[model samples]
Target chain A: MVSQLTRNERQLALVILSALALCGLAMAAIGRDDLIGGHGAFILLASLGMGFVVTSGYYHAEPSDERLAHYYDDPSKVGIVLAMIWVVFGLFIGDWVAWLLVYPEMTFDGGWASFGRLRPIHTTAVIFGFGGNALIATSFHVLQRTSRARLPDQLSPWFVLLGYNLFCLLAVTGYSMGLTQSKEYAEPEWYADIWLVIVWVTYFVLYLRTLARRKEPHIYVANWYYMAFILVVAVLHIVNNLAVPVSIAHAKSYSLFSGVQDAMTQWWYGHNAVAFFLTAGFLGMMYYYLPKKAGRPIFSYRMSIISFWGITFMYMWAGSHHLHYTALPQWVQTLGVTFSVMLLVPSWASAGNALLTLNGAWHKVRDDATLRFMMVAAIFYGLSTFEGSFMAIRPVNALSHYTDWTVGHVHAGALGWVALITFGSFYSVVPWLWKRERMYSAKLVELHFWLALAGTIIYVFAMWNSGIIQGLMWRTYNDSGTLAYSFVDSLIAMRPYYIARAIGGLLFLIGAAVGFYNIWMTARGALEESPTNADRPAAVPVAARTIEAGE
Target chain B: MDIDHNIAVVVAKSFGLFYLIALSIGVLVYVYWPSNGKRFDDAAKNVIHDEDAPWH
Candidate 1:
């Protein structure tokens, strides 16, 4: 049975075994007296046991001869499953964090489970674990389909999938143990960051290698977006995470930048993390899935090209807006605001292009819950980008800064746009990957859609009200010119909203669970009846094809 | 000394501003160039054309 395993699978097994042995040695060296060290050791042992069980099962299974002739989708399959698990875990942690705000006693002695330690865990888990995995899965699916080429080799995809997840594991565990470089988004200390760099560079090379082997004469626009995401993120991660560790064995590290320079560098990384990680990569998913689901050509290919360049160029300059009212040069703030405002043009162009692609497909969107998800995602993309530009203006930033308003704004994008589009794409891709005849439950898909939409609306509006009131109270003055509201007054006011926010988060979590269940049942072939035309080629726009042939 | 500092700031800002402008315009020209229209159109249709069997 082991002999039947591919070279890639065998290599992965070796890597896991060596890692487990190293973890054993490290555990012995660190001593189990310290609580944090004990926890780390326990996690390592558990992971090692799980790896052995899963690998043994995988190695013993026979690869179907029929599947070998088809597209390479196993890595994508692994990614999708991991993504679902992480989304649930991330959302659950996020809800706990929200509840911790209203119920301060929830911390209960303030160790690993305290809000400060767990907050980064929630953010990193969702953004990197959930969103990152979805991007990788969908990018592989889109790249292979769009490029009309096989992935260069099977080994690299597995390497990227397993390697990247290992980095996430180290990051989450280290954070819980109080290991960090004190950066916002790039908080993972030097060693973890370096590990990610290696994984990401391999991903970049694999993408380029596959593109070079394309059967199509031209590289697709979606691949271009994914490429930008991969390339720019690598650059940002490396620069922002430059730090010196106290010792090779210790988790402590000091960043290269200090004081105001550190603040500037952190936000620069934070803002671009959103741009490339959240926006560009997801845009890649949108370009492929939205048009395919709609059964239409993209509204304007030229507009896509123009906006791609525009977004890539404009977003780099907008990070400084995050440092408004700080010691960072006023001129730098001005530049940030200017470019952020300019960003709306390209942002809206992509959004409008997507909506216009649905011109004749409104009926399909109505009938198909997945299309509805993508359509709403496109609308939210427009709304969020507009709101972002408006907030970046200095006066608005002054009002919105350090308030729940910014939190509301981030969720409006993250929850409303990113998660929805990902869910939509997952619905379309999962059935195709398993060669299933539609999903096990279409009704459940519709149910999940409303749950998600309602949850986001409730979450965003609550935060907005909380933020505005907070901002106003902080600035209000008495007739004698003294401040009117004490700091405690604002805190008191936020209590009700925090409760409301937690309820919103709970709803989103329930919706995500519904999605996971539906996909799971679909994969297990729980449907009563299979559709006859399940394997039919998706309809492509005739006009676009004719134009292409003529060219 | 103040005059020299002012000159330095002006030189840096102007150079940065003009460089961005030229880059943007260059991108616009390259995208819209007539010769590349066929390529762009074909690229757009890649997803549609390869819908049947992506691996093939």
Candidate 2:
């Protein structure tokens, strides 16, 4: 079925389907003695599901002559194509690292490698590679549409893509070789960090040039958010990653700060990296696609600006919140806590604006999986922000800190907020890019949504409970004030939550696989396949109508 | 002790002065309204009128 599709689309489908098949076979072969292997299988299947959804969306429709004409003149496609390649390659590297971690015995060396190496590899691939590609691709497309201007110096966009992937490669290779500064977020060696800095500066320049040449009168709110993300993230990355390389040959570096100061600085980078890269960037996506998908103006432009500034100023201060009860100065902790509390207002402002933007289109939330994903993501963003601010309070941190609760909070934002929005943007754009009328099956999309949602809920709630319980138990004092529970006892108690969390991951992965299948069949099915060597065009019925509407 | 105390006092005063100046600038910018409703309208009109203007 996948063979009938285009090269990129076909390979993507094959990877996913093969992954799913591997999981199924593994499950049958290894009947549950060790669930670890089974869990790995589930992850592969889910990865495939993601690929399927993306490819199917890409191949659903044919580009019209006008759309093709625009492509003929521009180099943005070169960047886009490169971006796609980097994401695929990144996925493979991430998988290799993760696979090695999951089955350490399978390796030649029975060495126990920490998740520290694999975690960054997997995260950077999915977040920076996949999510970053989606952002750049969609931003290029949307900027063109809103500006009524062709992308500037198409070669530059390609440079951005190539340079970015090169940086990813450098980072991953360096990480595997054990060249790191040991920062949770800024783990990349100095050389890789330098590479990223160069690539990012180019991206910023390209974006600004394009904006300058826009034919539109007012810059869209999306541009504001995107630009802010770019600017603020650049500052954060530079400030936090100030380190000197040990030597050119080895991927070793030392941070400027030491001990607690380093931890504080790292979290400062870490949290704001979340704020700007994940939250701000996705908000930019939401601002554009939500309105475009709903076919309505944003609820209030004023609200957007207010939220934008509020988030920009407020989120920076909230980073210290991660240090809650740490020895990072009481005054600093108070600053973090206070700013975190203040962040809720801006967060809710964005969420409310997005929700209210769908004032009359609420019904579509039932029918349109894309809109539904965005809506749910918005809701989760609010929930995560509230939970984060609350956790920042020293009192609450006393119960939630260093527990699975923190993990739950992170996933609520990462899986629910970031992933959902990314998926929605893909759903909303791939059809336009592919020139398809609509997705092959809305039902599959809906299934994917529910499966992931259920998975997220179970996963988050289980962890939250487990974490708080553990925190409480650890702090609980007997009348004699002996340690309330041994560390081993806490570990035993956490087993149930881990099992539940894994199960949640399984369901989510299964949902993703279903989505993948739907997308694959959509691209490879009879309607998509060309009978003759006609060099068939992409099928975009709705965009055609929109063109007609313009006429 | 006397030298250290003097240095600390000098540093504090300098920091205080810098912050005050920065705050005033922020306040001034907040109050300033360079573009009114009419000016914004005129700018939009100008862009619309120049239909053949090159973009990019």
Candidate 3:
């Protein structure tokens, strides 16, 4: 990847790494007695490691300027690999946590390996590591095509991708070390937050710079969603992370808000993280890859417009629903539920738009596992949004909050919608990026689709059953109004479901493993029939040529 | 309950109502505008072309 850069950009990479290395060294020195110090050392070592990598490849002949005619895709390629690695890491941790619930003695005497610490590791790795990387990679691919432009510069794209990974690395490692602000999604302490701010600003600027160079007259719908994801996430992160660190040497910080206000702020950030980061960004990927693979135009451009604005206007207000039945004031909770219910309109609009776009492509969806992955994803998106709005109602939340039902809902979206869409997009992209006619093994893709579908079904159903049973057991009354079951009774009843959930997660993990292998083999040209032609990009699509002529 | 707190809640609620109404109108106008059909259709058709190359 470094060899693709001009010599000057290579030097710029070295300089950037060196500068970060200095900052890391300063941190290591100042915080030597604290967790911050450990993270500092990790940063320093990692930067030095990347610098060595750059220098090792520094002597390669400079890439020719003719490369400017093509889109810059090296960063996207690297980002995809990193995303796959993180997906495996994250899913493995998640299944481990599931099994730990079934068998409580599995942790090695608790401490860093305890459920509390490991849970965040699982969340961060999958959400920020896997999901974030996939979004960044596909955004680059989608943005360039939709905008009809090359990225403004080669070096900044690398800086954004690598620098974002560094932040994810810091966050996961920080969590494992028992260092956190105890916030749900925004758990990373002050330094990691500051670093992310820098990386994200670069990403936003890079995206806009590319868009500014577009030959297309109208910006695409996918770009709109990607832009919202980038912009809204920045706002959410900065606002929720408003804190005063104890000192430069310490990893701890005090939030600016306290009590109910803090709770409100955190959920506001948390739920919108779900909205922009997970939904909007992946929606961007779906809007591009699904239509492309199906060989169809989006069903309704006007509906896309309405859904985009409706989602934008509605999701911010729905966050308060998470604080329902708490001390967040009754009106705020009511406001949240109202918007949460209304959010169904836009959410279903986007989902229906995706499915409707496949009107003429049902045959492909039936025969092609890649399109099936996206079809199932749109269905799951519709299902989960309906379930979410239902659960947001205060009376419903009363039964569902703090139960595995919420966990079930989340996994429905995560596994069924988010992971499925990502796999579909990756399958479509990997072959294209690697200049292959098709994947290394279509049978493996078929196997993966079934495995993913079955796993999601089994996992979600188990959680739902266990959750409702537990809820009813707690709320049940004996004669004369005494509680019927102890909490331990509920736990005992949940054991079988926990075991089932673990197995379901294991199947999902194996499917992801299969996907990564297929992707890797395709990249290696394992299935390429014509090696010489494989080196060239696909014969340009016919429609593209006609479109170019028209333009 | 304090009167001031109640008043504040009422004001916020009213503002939210107005904001929602305005947002609904704005989105509908953008989606249904007479002249936007052609541009949006062109974009929907052409957005994913030139997958491996730029439009030049």
Please tell me which predicted candidate would have the highest DockQ against the true structure: 3
Candidate 2 local lDDT, A281-382, one digit each (tens): 889889888877887767766567667877887787677777866677676688788878988887998999889988899898877888999999999998
lDDT of all predictions: 0.85, 0.68, 0.92
- Taking the tens digit of each residue's C-alpha lDDT, what string does model 1 give over B1-56? 46664674687499878988998899889888999998877666656553546455
Please provide, for model 3 over A1-551, each residue's C-alpha lDDT reduced to its tens digit, 9 standing for 90 to 100: 77888899999999989988988998899999998888889899999999999999999998887887898888899999999999999999999999999999988995888999999999999999999999999999999988889998888988999999999999988888899999998999999999999999999999999999998879999999999999999999999999999998899999999999899999999999999999999999988999889988899989988889989879998899999878989988998999899999999999999999998889899989999999999999999999999999999999989889999999999999999999999999998898888989888899999999999999999999999998889899999899999999999999999999999999999999999999989889898344432466778889999999999
What TM-score between 0 and 1 does chain B of candidate 3 receive?
0.69
- Model no. 2, DockQ: 0.14
Model 1 spans with C-alpha error above 4 angstroms? A1-5, A8-68, A528-551, B1-12, B49-56
Of the candidates shown, which would achieve the greatest lDDT relative to the real structure? 3
lDDT of 1 by residue, A355-466 (tens): 9999888999998999999999999999999999999999999999999999999999999999999999999888888888688888888899998999899899999999
Clashing pairs in 3: none
Q: What lDDT score is found at residue A110 in candidate 1?
A: 60
- Give the backbone clash total of model 3: 0
DockQ of every candidate = 0.55, 0.14, 0.67
* RMSD of candidate 3 to true structure, Å: 6.4
Q: How high is the TM-score of chain A in model 2?
A: 0.78
